[model samples]
Target: MLHIVACIKQVPDTKIIKMNPKTNTMDRASAPAILNPYDAHAVEEAVRIKKRYGGIVSVLTMGPPPAVKAIKKCIEIGADEGYMISDRRFAGADTLATSYALTKALDKIQKIKPVDLILCGKMTIDGDTGQVGPGIARRLDIPPLTSVKKVEAVNQEEGHIIVHRKIEDGYEVIQSSLPCLLSVEKEINEVPYSSFPNMVKAARYEPHIWSVDELEDVNIKQLGLKGSPTIVAKVWAPPKPEGGKIFEGTPKDQVDQILSVILEKNELFQAKGGY
Candidate 1:
């Protein structure tokens, strides 16, 4: 059976998010969280592939225990199993740190069932950096394909997958070897409705959680903020422009006054150029 693994993330719903005036960081507790919208499409595509190819679908996520909500979402989407890697050591991770942690989890997953394919959303809304997918492929020494819009075929024996990748203006058809990672565009697939049984399973699902100790050759220094090369040096919201003072007048008087001001400002039209 084909083993398709999709990586998903839990993110703060930024629509209503408030920012700290002093620190300029999101007030996470004030905002409700949701499964990343882009990852939803990726999960749907993976489930679709699993249904057609007759394989088990698994999901992997590296986040806090609260992030298990995203894993359950995958269960509702038809994944057979969900794995979550969570540790306090993984806090304050940037793309690089996050990639390291996720790669460690990927290594763990590979030990059980050699993953045939790996899928990810185009990018996370919060981070907006799509580096993790390619980073995983590089770490695993496999091909990484990005912005994929369609999956043409997958041949297990040949160990290759054919796909259409989003390009500058259109798309490019490309082929890559199996055990490949793909970052997919939102147009890849439509999310299907959850059946009663799957919904029930999703509601009760408890994901397999792994800590730093379980992964192989994991460098503790590289797992979270400590391992990250990039740091958020500082963040501040743009100062809101002071509200403009509106001159109140009738339409005709307002128009006349506006034109008079403009004419007076122009030296050529003003009677006296100075004063």
Candidate 2:
């Protein structure tokens, strides 16, 4: 049976997030916690794959206990199983440290049932770094395919999967062996509304929660802030742009005014080759 693993996250709603200047951290209380948008798409894709291929779709996340909500969200989306790695030691982890912790959990899960494929979102909206997925792949020693736009095929018997990976101009088709990692773009799939049965099942579903101690062969130093090398020295919002000048006049007059303004910035236009 194909066992697909999706790495998901519970991130604060980016729309209402605020920074804590004093600690260089996010003001978690400022915004309601929600499933990461990109990860939701990953979960949807995994569920679709499960439906098509007849396998188990498992979702995993690393966050505090409240992150159980995110796991439930995956269940509602049709994931068969959910796992969460939550512990005080995992708090304040940067992408690298977070990846380390996640890989450990994945290793344990793998012993229980070998995973055929791993999926992740392109990036988390809260972090926006887009590094953790590839990081996990590196730690797991698997091929990393980022920004996947479509899943072309998953040949389990042949042990390979074909995908369209997004590139600068358009996309590139990739065929990687099974057990590879895929970081998917949001355009890959649309998450559909949950049916009544799924909702009811999700309401009663409980994810397998693991603490740092529960994870095998874990390095104490690599689980949290202690292992993070990149430090946020400060967190602050950038200055908002000034409002544009509104010229109120006839169409011809407005055109003349715009021309005058452009003339004043002719040097900038020339420098940017916008002339």
Candidate 3:
């Protein structure tokens, strides 16, 4: 049976997030965290693929102790097993360090059983950079594809996979070998409702937690904040724009006034039938 693992993350519920003006960081305690919306779609797609092809769908996440809940969310979404890599040493990780830690954990997961495919969301809302999926692929020396919109086909015996990739203005179809990583977009799949049994399993499931020492060839210089090259030198809330003039009039009068003002600003708008 094919072994598929999906990487997921937990992020602060950004809709209700509070920011710290002093440190210019998120006020995490003020907001409830949830499984990343995009990761949820990735897990859903992996589960669907397993259901069709017959395989196990496992999830792995690296975060603080609270991140275990994100793994459980994957279980609730129909994953069979979940792995969590939590440690103080993993704190303040940027994409580079985060992928390093994830690569170490994935190495452990592969040792027990060879993984056929690794799935990930295109990007995390908090980080905004969709680099971790490809980063993990780089560390593992596996082929990685990003912006996947559809899994056109999979051939386990011949070791082939075909997928549609999202691109500006259109899409592209590409084929690659197996044991590959795919970073998928949300439009690729719909997350289904979790079965009761799966919900129970997820609630009771304990993930395989690993520490810094557990990694095979981990370099302390590249495992956490120290290993990360990027840093948030400064941060602040978006500055509100200056006050604006509000125009009020009937629909026709308003249009005329607006056009007059616009034409006044730009002389090019004076021509008839001109945009």
Candidate 4:
């Protein structure tokens, strides 16, 4: 049976998050935390693949204890198992450090059951760097196929898979050997509402929780903030745009009103020597 592992994360809902004006940084408290949207799609796709070919879909994540909620969310989406590596040392990790830590956890999982395929979201909504997936692929020395829009086939006996990779104009069909990593696009699959049975299972699920110590061959210097090298010079929210005027009238009248407003603005600009 295929053992597919999908990497996931719990992130602050960016849509509802607010920025701190004084610190010019995100006010994480202002928003509720949820499973990363892109990662959800990745988990959904993995579950779909498992349904197509007989296999177990497992999800892995790294975060605080509360992140177990994210794992439960994955279970609600039909994942067979969930693993989370949580520890205080993993706090404040940048993408590079995060990848290093996850790789160690993956090594332990591999020992338990040989992984046939690894799937990841194209990018996390909070970070948007889209680096960790490729970073893990590089560390494992496996082929990383990114921007995958479709999984055409997974030939287990032949030990190969075919996928449609999204390109500028359209998509390109590419085939790769097994044990490859795919960073999938959201369009690859539609995530449906969780089934009642899955929801019941998720409610009672308790994922395997591991600390940094549980992972084998871990580098203490590469676990968290201490290991991160990327320096964020500053973080600020874009200035709110000025409110717009409402042109209330028929189409022809609105057109005339718009032209009049444009002329008025032009005259003011000329008066102010704005050319």
Candidate 5:
């Protein structure tokens, strides 16, 4: 049976998240944590592929203990198994260090079960760089098919898969070899509501959690903050746009008011020789 692994992450709900005025950083505690939306689609696509081709789907993540919640959420989406690597050493990792750490975990997973294909979301909500997926593929020396919007076919026998990759104006069809990695677009599939049985399984599920030590041949210097070279100099919220004047009157009066405002601006411009 084919073994497909999907990479996922738990991120704070960005829409509801707030920024700390003092620190000028994200206030993670202000919002609830949830599965990354793009990664959810990746997991859903993996499940669909399994249902179509008759294989096992596994999900992997690198995060803290609370990330187990994200793994369980994947289970509810129909993933067969989940794995997580969590530790303080992995804290404050940028994309480079993160991909390095995850690549190590993936190596372990590949040894346990030969993975036919690897799947990932286009980007994470927290870090929208969309670099980790391609970075992992590069480290593994495999082809990275990014912006995948549709999985046309998975010809396991032929050891190749066909997919539609999104482009600027339209999408293009491409065929890639097996063991390749895909960074899928959100439009790839619509994730449905979780089934009752899946929900039950998710509630009772406990994923395989590993620390940095559990991974084999890990380079200590390349694990976390020590490995990260990129530095965030500063962060601040954008100034809110000035509010427009409200015209409280009938349609004719509102139109007249707008015309008057336009004429006033035009006169000001003319005064400044802006004919």
Candidate 6:
């Protein structure tokens, strides 16, 4: 059977998140955490592939203890197993450090059962850098396919997968060998509602939790904040723009004001095919 691992994350629901002014850090307690939206799609895609190709789908993540909520979510989505790597040392990890920790866990998972493929979201909403997927693939010495829009075909016997990778203008079809990493777009698949049985299973799901000490071949210097070279210098919200000026007076005056403003930026209009 094919073996697929979907790497997912629990992210603060940024839609309702608030920022702390004193420390410039997110007030995570103010917002509920949920599985990363794009990662949800990645899990959905992995489940679909398993249904089509016959595989064991395992979802993996690195976060605090509460991150098990995200793993159970993958179980509801049809993943057969879930694993989490959590420890105090993993706190304040940048993408590089985060990827290092994840790669170590993945290596350990590989020892249990060789992985045929790995899946991930295009990017985390919180980070938005889209680097960790490729970083993990690099560490594993596998090809990295990013921004995948669809899976065109998978030939297990031939040991290859074809995908539509989104580009600036359109998408390109890429055929990659097995043991590859894919960072998928949200548009790749629509997640189905969990079945009642799956819901029950998710509720009772117990994920394998590993700490830094439990992971094999871990370097003390590469497990967390100490391993991160990049540091946030500062963070602050951008200044809000001034309110728009009201065009009052006559209808003709308003029309003239609009025309004058348009004329001032005539080049922009021309660039957009305006007369």
Q: lDDT of each structure?
A: 0.87, 0.93, 0.90, 0.94, 0.95, 0.93
Off by over 4 Å in 5: 245-275
- The TM-scores of all predictions, comma-separated, are 0.86, 0.92, 0.90, 0.89, 0.90, 0.92
* Whole-model alpha-carbon lDDT for candidate 4: 0.94
After superposition, which runs of candidate 6 have C-alpha atoms over 4 Å from their true positions? Answer: 240-244, 249-251, 259-275
The residue pairs that clash in candidate 2, if any, are none
Ten-residue stretch with the least lDDT total in model 1: 266-275
lDDT, candidate 5, equals 0.95
lDDT of 2: 0.93
> Residue 111: error of model 4 in Å?
0.7
Superposed model 2: Cα runs more than 4 Å off = 19-25, 249-253, 266-275
Local accuracy of candidate 2 as per-residue lDDT tens digits, 67-186: 999999999999999999999999889999999999999999999999999999999988799999999999999999999999999999999999999999999999999889999999
Question: What residue pairs are clashing in model 5?
Answer: none
The superposed Cα distance between candidate 5 and the true structure at residue 268, in angstroms, equals 12
* Global CA lDDT computed for model 3: 0.90
Give the alpha carbon lDDT tens digit for every residue of 29-95 in model 5: 9999999999999999999999999999999999989999999999999999999999999999999
228 in model 1: Cα distance from truth in Å?
Answer: 0.6
Model 2 TM-score, all chains together: 0.92
What lDDT tens digits, residue by residue, belong to model 6 across residues 10-82? 9999889988899887788999999999999999999999999898999999999999999999999999999
- Candidate 6: pairs in clash: none
